[model samples]
Target: MTHSVKPRARAADKRRRLTIEAARVLHEQGVERTTLADIARAADVPVGNVYYYFKTKDELVLAALSEHSAHLDELTGRLDQLPDPRDRLEGLIRAWVDQRDVAARYGCPTGTLAVELDKRADGTLDTEAGTVIRRLLDWTGHQFRALGLPDPEDLAVTLISAYQGMSLLANALRDPDLMARQGDRLLHWLDSLQSPDPTA
Candidate 1:
């Protein structure tokens, strides 16, 4: 008999599974150690089939990173609905901490992959990750700017930087309590930003 093509539904499902498994393997073993064969074995597909979903390991990483960024975009969008800038900042900080706690408890595939991808100065993954981050920051800054603060962008950077640093620290300590405490401190600092600057 002549060859026949698989249905599109099955192909889409396979690609979804491949992306999920690729994230898991990358999280456990890091990008370098996660061979396409490893992903195929974990996904229970032919070794050559990994290329069907992802042309390369880098594509897999970009997909995983995109997945993680979606999590932030959805959550942060809700934070934007709150009109009070200070409250929005506080809520956003806590939300971010909570997300990190859950991800850390679950092995944090995206964060794990980020460690390696971040080191590369030039790569598709790096470029995409940067875009995600800058957008998050800019959106965050918009929330503060809405409050009519004189330097909302400056305050926004301060808030985002605090969240980023505390995430890694809490992940290392594996302590949700620490994250909460640190997040509270950051929120308090954001509140202080609302006051007019010395020159203003």
Candidate 2:
């Protein structure tokens, strides 16, 4: 006899699928254009089921942002495997550079969504949507601090801004090579910041 699946397990599975589908749809279509029905269709769940997991579109947006946050955390953790903070930062830049094609086609997921959410005053996302960039800033700032920069936070902001700017231009121009070139410039800048350690 086949055993029946538990309610909680099924619910968790549905929630996970919803989150994944929401992220995909939100990335492909801006928040204003993506409806719950689109997400439900993508996730293969009943449209009514979306309400059980997310009461409103805003809730699903926040859930998608949370998913992006988790992805950033995982990337940070992977970068941490590098011994040097500078190397970690390079790894971060390289990671973005590697996604140049995707960025060109769809824009940076976090950057695009953050800007979209900020333009709204309907309480759809507010400052909470910006947490994705803030997390990157904080993490990059920490790496800069480890590199002994006096103004690590500012440096972090600059780096993040540069990456965002590159993404914006690349997406607007639909030029993946532009992003890769910018990535090289960022790596060169990072290299310039390096000097012979006084202690060594």
Candidate 3:
């Protein structure tokens, strides 16, 4: 029983590693260009082993999508530790700013994946990709609601759209500084949304 458990655990670990590498490769190379061999090489697993874990490229893509979703959850969960909704939102922007270099080179991980998968005629992959962006919109709206905003949902769309637009430009022009500058503007805009102190 102990020996069997060890092999199962190892298999799970290898599967996870493959998914992680797949996400990285897909982000860097785009979905259509990345092959199973690329993912296997990145993960340091045999190409044959990749088949054992994921029968097709689509299956691997699904695993990578799941990885992106989990990463979003982790990021939001970390920011939720902040006491203030404003602070949480600011933290999120800052996090993106920190990744400006990567964004400039490969584009926003979640955003790029969504845009690419959206072109698929099958619709299934695109639907799954849409959920990641939807989750971000919903989470951002929740933060706006916490701040007592009258138009939380609209504000959420505006904020996310701004970020996505900036990300697109940054990647197109290969400018990391653009993301930093836009992040600062976004932080300032968020600050402006707060109600002024009545006592003052």
Candidate 4:
């Protein structure tokens, strides 16, 4: 196979590389304690260069959230291969929990940013997370419809809400054991959804 790179592609590559390095910094430190100068130092790039790619700290945080959401998108993409709504829903629950687990292992930046969002209502970083989460739930609902569930949208909402609730609960408990238990029970609910009729 032969390949060619366009100028736009090259520019995107540079930005991606910078964003990736920044993500590592954010994961290690945190959004509140992190500064563009710190990321520039870590990335071995000039502060001006970091500013060239991202105009503000909020934009950089949004990029980190984008990176996290991209991980979710990749897992959800696998549902196309499952071919069973029941299996897909179960897989979705497991995948989402694992996403949280992995993010938790890395200090759970998504959850951290969410708390920041609440503290500063008009911070605007919420826009990216809100959109990404909605997209994830929308995709999950589509799978629910395929499984013959009634009101797939409502079911998706419930599942998403449950997952978010468990995430917050796990953060509070800080116990991996409880997280795994809640994850199993969450998937069990999805399994129950495979019935001919689902109430609520």
Candidate 5:
């Protein structure tokens, strides 16, 4: 029984490593250009082992997408622990700011993958890729709603759009400062949202 469990654990670890490496390769090279061999090399697993874990490239891509979604959930779950909704929102922006260099180099992992998959004619991969953004949107919207905002969903969209736009510009321009500056502006915007309306 112990030996069987050990092998199962090792297999699970290898599978997870493959998915993680796949996500990294996909983020760096885009989905169309990434091959199973690339992922296997990056994960330091045998190419045949990759086949054992994922029968095809699409299955591996799907696993990578799930990995991204799980990461996003963990991040948002951490942010959700903050006592203040505004603080939570600001924390989200700060996370982007912290990752600005990576975003500038490779673009937002989730964003880039989603955009690339969205171009495919089949539409299946696009749906899977979208779950990451949907989770982000839902979490952000929940923060806005908690703050008693009238247009929580709209506010969430606005914030996420700003981040995505900044990411695109930073990556296109290869300017990490652009993301940092955007983060400052977004932090100010969050503060503005919390300000008491003069009309009130």
Candidate 6:
């Protein structure tokens, strides 16, 4: 079987690469602290060239947010493919816990970025930033509902709160192990969930 090398789609590839890099820098340094120049340096694109893709800092941040949003959506869809609803929830937990080192060092990517952007003086990007968490909440709620749980929305809020709270403490205390330990506890909690009474 003969094969030929695929050619690069340079513009689209560069935009995608630059967007991912921007998301990384935004998560690590934060939206306010991160500049297009910083993202360009991280993306290895010329600073002047960045303007060709994103005209302003807000535009780049939006691109990063869009990238993050798509990632969360993809993750949720993948989780939904699990044969068991419980497994799906646990998979989501494992996904976040797998990032223990990064979470401990930089905090939860979505949580931190959402909070940072929400607290911005301008408040222009607040709603866009919040969509990340909202998407997670909605997806988690759907999973809980799939498990035949009443109060699925509430349960989803509790689970997300627990994950975000652990990330916050782990980051604040600089304790990377804390996330893993909390993840273990979360797994146990998952095991303990009983399907709520539908009639209640």
Most accurate candidate by lDDT? 3
Report lDDT (Cα) of residue 60, candidate 3: 91
Residues 1-200, candidate 4: write the lDDT tens digits.
Answer: 12456756766776787687677787667777889998888767778888878999888887878887876678777776887877877887676566665444543455556666656657667666677777877887898888777899998898877777776666666655556787899877776665474565
Judged by lDDT against the true structure, how good is candidate 5?
A: 0.91
- TM agreement with the true structure for every prediction: 0.76, 0.93, 0.96, 0.78, 0.96, 0.91
Q: How well is each residue in 38-155 modelled by candidate 3, as lDDT tens digits?
A: 9999998989999999999999989999999999999999999999999999999999899899999988888898888888787678888888899999999999999988789999
TM-score of 3: 0.96
Clashing pairs in 4: none
Better of 2 and 4 by lDDT: 2
Against the hidden true structure, what lDDT does model 3 obtain? 0.93
Single out the weakest 10-residue window by summed lDDT for candidate 6: 1-10
Count clashing residue pairs in model 6: 0
Report the lDDT of model 1 for residue 119: 82
Name model 3 segments beyond 4 Å from true: 196-200
Which ranges of candidate 6 are over 4 A from the true structure? 1-8, 197-200
Let me know the TM-score candidate 1 reaches against the reference structure. 0.76
In angstroms, give how far residue 40 of model 3 lies from its true place: 0.6
- Cα deviation at 103, candidate 6, in Å, is 0.3
User: What order do candidates take by lDDT, descending?
Assistant: 3, 2, 5, 6, 4, 1
lDDT of 2 by residue, 1-200 (tens): 23456777888999999998898899889999999999999999999999999999989998999998998999999999999999999999999999999899889998899888878887548577687889899999999999987789999999999999999999999999999999999999998885447897
Worst 10 residues of 5 by lDDT: 189-198
Error of 2 at 134 (Å): 0.9
Whole-model Cα lDDT of every candidate shown, in order: 0.71, 0.91, 0.93, 0.73, 0.91, 0.88
Candidate 4 ranges with C-alpha deviation above 4 Å: 1-12, 27-29, 99-111, 197-200
